[model samples]
Target: MIRLDRDGPVWTLTLDRPDKANALTREMLVQIRDAAAEAEQAGLAALILTGTGKVFSSGADIDAARAGLATDGVWEEVSSRIARLPFLTVAALNGTLAGGAFGMALACDLRLAVPGASFFYPVMRLGFLPQPSDPARLAALIGPSRARMLLMAGQKIDAETALAWGLVDRIVPREALVEEARALAEAPVAAPEHIRRTIKRMIRG
Candidate 1:
């Protein structure tokens, strides 16, 4: 469900579920978390998350999420592992990032998006609550009002406005995102021990 490629200090994680628009399944979530743990142990400077096809992620597999909800605490347990990794997580949004898809990208410390990219969270349609982390991360990124608009109204914001709103750190041409993220990752690294623990603590805090 994920393909990991290491290039020096960067670890790129490609969502390998393109056939389903990268809809995340339970097993896929576990694989992603494991890769993040590995990246931290390997002293990688950062991790990049993206999808293989035009879509970044349509969100968690609704069918999967439905099946797991009654089982108690599945998504939280796994996504938290990836979210709290030692190295920085970068979501290289290739296209529309929607539904719980925002949660995965939100887990990232920074985001680099392409021109046509957009973000949305449509939890109401599924009759579920936002994982406690969503609102916090969204508010922190784009402020309370905008976060409310996006998360509650299920509004989708374009990449340019997302940059201006600070939801994304930067915007690049779609053709240049991977190279740009890798270059950005190279410069922001901290001493391994310091960066690793610091990022983990920050996310958890």
Candidate 2:
């Protein structure tokens, strides 16, 4: 499930399935995509993606995956929507980030993580390849070598290492994650929305 909250110009989307480590399900993904679309339509200044409890997300739901639900399309759609939002987007990784959930964080314009949080890519260990766009996006953030270390070697990187690799912009204390994310989200609010969106597009291109 997802929780959407608005405070002034910032819209926050929190993954609420803490009992399962916030493991993503098809229905949850749909809700997240819809909430993001709604936030964009409302012309919010920024969007924050985070999770409840100690894990950002455990990745796609195994039950859903076993049921043959197609996740690639949903992942692509949701990530693309967040990536192309006219306003700033931040991923506050309050805890562990693994599997497909990494793609969600990578899609965000900025990333913040709790000092104890960690990032892992388990595609090799899981006997599956990452989504096509994932490799390039990961490479873009932390460079090809580190991306290779993650994807090919199944390396798990701690917050400090991730920051050093340029994967996360900052590492905040667990208690300060939300406040820090809010501050980062507030940074571009004074800029013209069109200018920010255009520049984002140009940079991506």
Candidate 3:
């Protein structure tokens, strides 16, 4: 389940599935897409994404994926739509990130992780290629060398190492993740739509 809350100009989208380590389902994906669309419509200045429990997310449930009831296919559309939001978006990484969970985190403009959190790319064992947009974002965040190390070698980096690689902007105690994220979200930015659109066009071009 996904929880949507609006605290003044801040919008918080929580992925609530602690029982399953916050794994996302197809319905949750639709909810996420709708949430992003609604936040855009509401003109939110900032958005925060987080999950409950010890794990930020365990990625997509393989059972659901095998059953063809997962959102794996629709994720690109959802992620692209989320990236189009004018507001600054932060992914509060409350715990370890891997698989589709990592993809979701990469979708955000900024990622704030907790100290105990880590990252892993396990797709190589499955013989599947990396997610397309993810590679570019990874490269932008961690640079070319680290991106290659992560994708080619399928290495997992701890929170500290991730920080060193620039994959994560800030690291804090698990308890402080939300507060830090909210503070960042509430901070001011130039939200000029035309400028943002032009910049986005140039980036895409």
Candidate 4:
């Protein structure tokens, strides 16, 4: 279940299946991918990805993972779409982020998390490879050794550790998570689209 909401120039895509820790299914992944595309097409100035409950996402649903969802291309497609957007992208991690779900957040330009949130990707334990772009993107953010600690050793680091390791940009109180993201977006939202896009490309270079 994915909910995409538009508030002027900002678009927020929320994972709505709190009951299952917002575990992703193929259908949900498709929805997220489509929503990201729609937001970019509509010239969104900023996009935020968050969740409805204590967990941002527990990654792919267990049943779905076993059914080949873990290795699905849709995950890469979704993350790639987000990565290519000209606007600012933020992952407002509400809680733990695990498994294939790591791809989407890793693609974001910035990440903000709640103190209670944890980060890990258990591909090594689960006997599956991560999405193609995830490992490099992850290593770029947090460094190769730390990325290995999470991917190879299966270490689950808390919010503070994640911030220190560069996995997350800030640790915001849960109540203010999305608000903080919106605050970060204010400047970009007010700028011209071409100006924002130019700056983003300059940063990428």
Candidate 5:
């Protein structure tokens, strides 16, 4: 399930199925993709992605994956929409991030995680190529060799190691994750849209 919350100009999109470790079904992925589009259409200041439980996402729902969701083009579309958004984007990782779910976090401008979170993408071991945009984004964040560690070697990295490798920008306590994300967005949210867009373009260009 997916829940979108608005606080003034900042919107937080939460993955709400804790019982399943927030495993994503195709419907959930579509909701996430639609939310990203909605944020851009509304000219929102910031968008924060987070989840309700101790695991951000266990990746695609097993049943859905077996039904071909694993290689679905919707994954690329979702991450690409987020990556192209001009507003500040943050992935407030409540717990471990795994599998195909890596794409969304990688597309975000920043990623923050709880101290206990771990990161991994088992695409290779799972016998599926990752979503098209994922490898490039992953290499851009944490470097090719380290990207290889996760994607190729199938290693699970702890939060501290993730931070050290640049996979996550900061490690925040679980209780404060969303609050910290809002704080980071304060400036961008308050700035004029043009100014925010300009800075983002400058940095990303």
Candidate 6:
């Protein structure tokens, strides 16, 4: 499930499946993709992705994955859309980020985490590989060695470690996470829209 809220130039998309740890189902992924598309069309200055309750996302739904209904392509598409958005994008990790959800967080232009938040990549443990774009983008942000530690060794790093490793731009208290993200978003609004969009495209490419 997803919830979209708009406040001035910022649009926030919240993963709303607390009972399931915000684990994404195929339908949820589709909804996210559609939401990203909508945000792009709306010409919003910033987009913030967050989750309800404690967990940011537990990744794809296991049952859906077992049935072959949830595929890497779906997540790849969603992350790609978010990456290509022509405005500032932020991943406000309210809690743990693991599995395919890591790719989504990595795709954002900025990442903010709460003090106890952590990052994990479980592909090696699950006997699967991440979407092709995931590793490259992740490595670009945190370097190849640390990326390997996460993707290959399944290392889970807490907020401070993530900040030191350059995985997150900032770590704020849980209650201040959203406010800090909003402030970051607001700061970019003074830049020319075209310049921001062009720079983001250049960086992503």
Per-residue lDDT tens digits for candidate 2, residues 143-183, read: 99999999999999899999999999999998988889888
Q: Candidate 1 on 1-205: residue-level lDDT in tens?
A: 7899987777899988788988887787777777877877887778888888878988778688788642335556555766777777788988878876677788787898899888878876556777667799889888999998887787878889999999999888888989888777765464565766675687667
lDDT of 2: 0.86
Q: What is the C-alpha lDDT of each candidate?
A: 0.79, 0.86, 0.80, 0.94, 0.94, 0.88
Q: In candidate 4, what are the lDDT values of residues 130-204, reduced to their tens digit?
A: 899998999998899999999999999999999999999999999999999999999998999999999999999
Candidate 3, residue 186: lDDT: 50
- Comparing 1 and 3 by lDDT, which wins? 3
Candidate 4 regions with alpha-carbon error over 4 angstroms = none
Candidate with the larger lDDT of 2 and 3: 2
Query: How does residue 163 of candidate 2 score in lDDT?
Result: 95
112 Cα displacement, candidate 5 (Å): 0.5
lDDT of 5 by residue, 1-205 (tens): 8999977789999999999999999999999999899899988889999999899999999999999999899999999999999999999999999998999999999999999999989988999999999999999988999999999999999999999999999999999999999999999977999999999999997
Clashing pairs in 3: none
The digit string of per-residue lDDT tens for model 6 on 1-205 reads 8999977779999999999999988889889999999989987889999999899998888898787744558888998898889999999999999898877798898999998887898889888889778999999888999999999989999999999999999988889888888898876677777877887778767
The 10-residue segment of model 6 with minimum total lDDT is 64-73
Supply candidate 3's per-residue lDDT for 6. 83
| lDDT at position 82, candidate 5 | 99
Ranking according to lDDT, highest score first: 5, 4, 6, 2, 3, 1
Q: Evaluate model 5: give its TM-score.
A: 0.99
Where does candidate 1 have its weakest 10-residue lDDT segment? Answer: 69-78
User: What is the Cα-based lDDT of residue 12 in candidate 2?
Assistant: 88
Candidate 3 lDDT tens digits, 1-205? 8999988668899999989988878788889989999988887767899989878887777787677644356667668778888767899999988776667688887899998998887667656666667788889888998887877788888999999888889998888899998888554334555554455457656
TM-score of each: 0.87, 0.94, 0.89, 0.99, 0.99, 0.94
